[model samples]
Target chain A: MTSDNTKPWLRAEIAQWLREGIISDEQAQRLLERYPSTPEPVEYGGGKGVFASLGVLVFGMGVMLLFAYNWAEMHRYAKLGSIFFGVALSHGLAALIKDPRVSSSLHLLGTMLFGAGIWLIAQVYHFSAHYPDGFLLWAMAALLMAWVLPSLSQCLLGCALLTLWSAVEVLEFNVLHFWALAVLLLLQLPWAYWQRSPLALTVVLMLLALALLVNSWHLQEGAALLHACLLAAMYLCAEHFSPRMSWSGCGSVFRRVGLPLWLALMLIFSFADAANIVVQLDGQTGAAAPLTWSMLFVLGAAWLWVLLDKSLRPRSPIQIAECALLLLPLLVLAAISGGVHKVGMIMTAANLSVLAYGVLFIVRGTSSLDRRQLVLGCGLIVLLVGLRFTDLFESLLARAGVFLLLGVLLFLAGLRYSRQKQRRLQEQRHV
Target chain B: MSRLRAILLLLAIAAQLGTLAYMVADKEAIIRHGHTVYLRTLPLDPRDPMRGDYVRLAYSLNQLYPSRLPGLQGLVPARRGEVVYALLRPVGDGVYELDGIADRAPESGVFLRGRVQAEAVAGEALRVNYGIEQLFVEQGQGIDIEQRQRGEAGFRRSMEVALAVDEQGRAIVTGYRWAPLAISVSPAPEIDGAAATPRLLVQLKNLADYPLAVVDNAEHCGVVLTVVNRLASSAAAPCGRYLVSREDIIELAPGAVHRFTIDLAHRRWFVDGGDGLQDVREFAPVSSLRLVYRSPAALQEASAEINLWRGELHSAPFSLRGFE
Candidate 1:
């Protein structure tokens, strides 16, 4: 309080200003606070950076070693031990690293070593005739690892290798192998779902289907049918699960394309079997009348259902085309059942119906159509009509005539439409 | 309201269309052609009762084993998409000589040839003649139906052979075609048809790749039983019956029929000692005799006795059809 000129923590000049009251004590204090703590020059050291870099080098060497140790040449026990050691050591090293970049790199290396080790183990077990259970154990281990490291590539690798092993086991007529593979597939679904990995989901679904196919051979008719039904169910489940994942652009495309393709294939497969049912039942029971009539009834009902449903969602061109195509085979079957002569009549009628629909679609699409809609609608109509006429006019002369007529008409229409559109646009601009 | 109603209506319509489509697709015709008859069914496998893996077909429609065909020596220029047909001339009973498209006029008995086509359908252009393949009892039942039901039938037997021919129609047999197959026929059962002639159900279960052909003999005459019915047994559980319920028989080419006698009369007619009326009463003959058809490689001729007592017929259990 008595004007201490030698301020305890301040420089001499600053202390004088505080004592004379040239500057307020608060300002002096503020100035002192702003001054650097240490004015002395400091020396530099690169120790930590060097140490971190060394760690990375060691991890890289370990990766090289991991690759060099060929699991294929090693005995089963050695392979198993090596895989265990490799996975543990690499993962542990990864966990100890603190730097994000270094840790992620280490994690990746560890996962690769782990995956290679597991795959090697599977291969060894797969080839070993004495140890049938080796494949199952390997599959289980891979499945467990997938769950533990959901984001790691190791998970997918594990799932895939396990799937292959399960396939072999199934082919060998091992029921246990079939169920085990199924379980692994089922486990991958949720993991893939949780991880939002569409790729993993797709692979798992495909593998499941393959396993079903292999197992279907040993099964009885009832069992085989059941297996097919199960496959259809699994596909349905996949379709349901797909929307939940953060699909990539390509994945989205596949979802759009692949789902429809898969569904169409399923429909074809189902229809093929359904068609055979009529013939099979007729032969077995020697009762063609009931079977034929029932088939017709069923076909009619299906046609009507498709037409009504399609009318409701008129926007979906694919659905409309599918429904229409589905009707052709049904009509053909009906015609065949009636007689060879009736088949001819039905073919003509079907041709006319398709042509009319095509023309109507073309007109509507052209009038209201954007370019894309016009192209799609006209293209579809032409294709349908062309296919129908090909079937309708069995004689080469008639078919050639129809084909030429259609080609000329389509060209003329397209040319006229373009010319008219251009003229209209020019007139509007002038006005 | 309209949207919801529309959705419901759409669904109803779809269901109806699906049902109708299912019915139409299911319509199939079972045509009987020549000595061969065709029945449409969801395809079935002809499994052998004894062998777990193979089936014994009722008829042979597959190409002959490559070894059996006379002159398929080396590779021939096969068209890319054109189906190649081979004409097989019979060398002996159940044996055939093979000729390619280039081969000259051929003597014929029952010729088995195949066209390799782009697709399974009748018109799919054939690619080449691997060999003289035979048709199985149940071949191409419906469009795509055979492939669909193949899984349920277990293992399939394919005729293995390679055939080649020069432009002159002269054929050289390259190698003997053999399939890992076993074929057998059940003894004719002793059941009287509504017509009183002993009705027989002969099953040709093809257990191997070689198409099974039983030369129909003049002695055995009845509708070649295409539809086989399973006669009930008293035992709750019976084993060794591969085709327990029903099956379709494969059709054979005309004039290829071989004759064999199926004796309907029983060997024993009288009992030695019994009750006074029973003693005087003669035992009526009811046992059935049938010809057994084993393939060319079979050690013993395939035959069986189907014993009938009081109207019940019993067949002797045999080994798996293909293995024997």
Candidate 2:
């Protein structure tokens, strides 16, 4: 047999061999069918082209008719009828078109034109002091089109417009307008599922949540707070349920970066709340609430550290970073309770804890301490120590002196690392 | 190559034409057309100056209403978008009746009606209930006269009417109805030679269409000199003239004529040639003059002024300063 035919025969022989004893019947069938003959490419510009052209013409004519009728000036029902008819015609055309290229392009153009046409009709009606019933229709059509196509541009436009319309309706004090936004979010889900588009889904969800928050704020204060809390809780739940579904990164990096940031914000808010309570109490009863809530959150963070230590893998950066974050709130609480004088004691303890963690991380370098982890761990230790001295010194000049000393230590460390690398390279060359 | 370019050009033209056609086809029909007249009214009750003499009237383009469906509050809230018509049934002297109804719902309040179904029939009207307290006559017939002679007793009148809006959005006001207000006209003594300058001259003539009475000591009004252009070294010549009661000038009958002259040359003074002439040359100035009259009843006071610098004529600015 010729070279090409030899390859095919060998594939058949292997398939028969697998079918007999080695591989299962299912495996043999899969291998045999894998090399099916290629189908002929589809030809363009025939009956299909004619049909598509006809479809476009029909859709365009329908748009013209809808425009001529001044559907916007008609009653709400009539406007809804016209919009539904127009959208149905456009979508029908999209489905009937056989060629992918023609289908996509036609779908884009037809939907856009239909949307713009409806918008124009509404505007005319509004300006003429007539009934403007086209807005609802346009919103619905845009959302449906977004789901049908799921093209990036279409989805983005539809989402943005629907969100804006919802906001406008809310401002007009119509609570029912939120349904349109809900519809848009629902439409996005299918596209997200189909493409496995996690990033897109996240962004769209965040935007939807934000819209809900803003609308709630306008409608009711308690509602706004509840909505925001729900959105944050949802994110946290999502992170916990499927850790791999976290789009940001692997577990360690996200925990190390995300935990400290989350804790810091919580601390800031707690402090602000405590300050307000103290001031208010001083004005009224001359007794503060003892910063009890803030202290409780701090204690909660400590409990979280102990829990993480037991649950997480030892020497995990996430475990270390989470512990550090959990300790930070406690430090702040101690400072607040004992005044500035006790800050130095808290800082010293934190510094020693951080240094010990850093040394442990360095020793575990064979597994986790890459360049980034090494820098982050050691840098954090130095930062804690430096912050302690700065707080203890209490004067700008003395603080600057402490920073200068820390900077010298970092410079020496970097120099020593480079020297060690050079010695290793030289040793390798001599050997 | 040229054919391809031509085809592109044709495509662009076609697209533009399509857009233009769409816009034209979608253009909103002008449902109603009417005039808006604004006027100030002074209330007859003397104790209430807060009810100023002038009442501003507005003729709206369209009246709007909420969508008729229940539970649709705050949706399309602006009422200026509904096609509305007002039916004015004549009430009595100085007052015509007003019943505003939308073309879509006749029983509705006089407010604009919106969201009428597409299949709605004609003659359906909506009512708008503005709850306005008073109505005044439309403005536009009697001439607006600024100054009248003291003790002059005659009447002045003005009128306007709202048009009827039909089911098909047609607006029609059938006949010109009269809105009349009675005013007592009076005449005042005119000063001689009020304007006699070569560059500028002003002549006051009695042009009243009805009989008027002129009185002496009817409270002489002051003439304000807005600007004095220059002071001649010669004694300041009278730049203005005021009649000393009724004796200074003859009483003017309807259509009667009067004249006055002011000479700017009399005020010019030739001093020692050098410094005095320089001062005079440096001091070129302009002046404005206004005529003011006060009535014995304290109700008929008016002023007329002319600017000398810009040579522009201006009426005395109306003052509600004492009303409230």
TM-score of each: 0.32, 0.38
Candidate 1 error regions (>4 Å): A1-84, A96-135, A174-185, A217-260, A263-394, A401-431, B1-324
Fraction of native Cα-Cα interface contacts (under 8 Å, chains A and B) also present in model 1: 0.00
Highest TM-score model number: 2
TM-score for predicted model 1 compared with the true structure: 0.32
Worst 10 residues of 2 chain A by lDDT: A1-10
As a whole number from 0 to 100, the lDDT of residue A79 in candidate 2 is 52
lDDT of 2 at B234: 26
Question: Per-residue CA lDDT of candidate 1, range B150-188, in tens?
Answer: 322332222232223333222212222322321223335
What candidate 2 keeps of the native contacts, as a fraction, is 0.00
> For candidate 2, what is the total of clashing residue pairs?
41
Q: Can you tell me the DockQ of model 1?
A: 0.01
Expressed as tens digits, the lDDT of each residue in A1-431 for candidate 2 is 00011233335445446645888877777866754433222222356544654565466555654444333235644554454455455545655777665754465455555655554343332222211233444445445555545444345545655666667556653443456546645766446545445434544665566566567656443234323433432333232322223232222222333334332333222333323322222211212213233334445554554445443222335445545544553455334433433433433444454555455443332122134545755566565555456335788888788778767756655565465445445544654
- lDDT, candidate 1, residue A416? 54
Model 2 chain B is weakest, by summed lDDT over 10 consecutive residues, at: B303-312
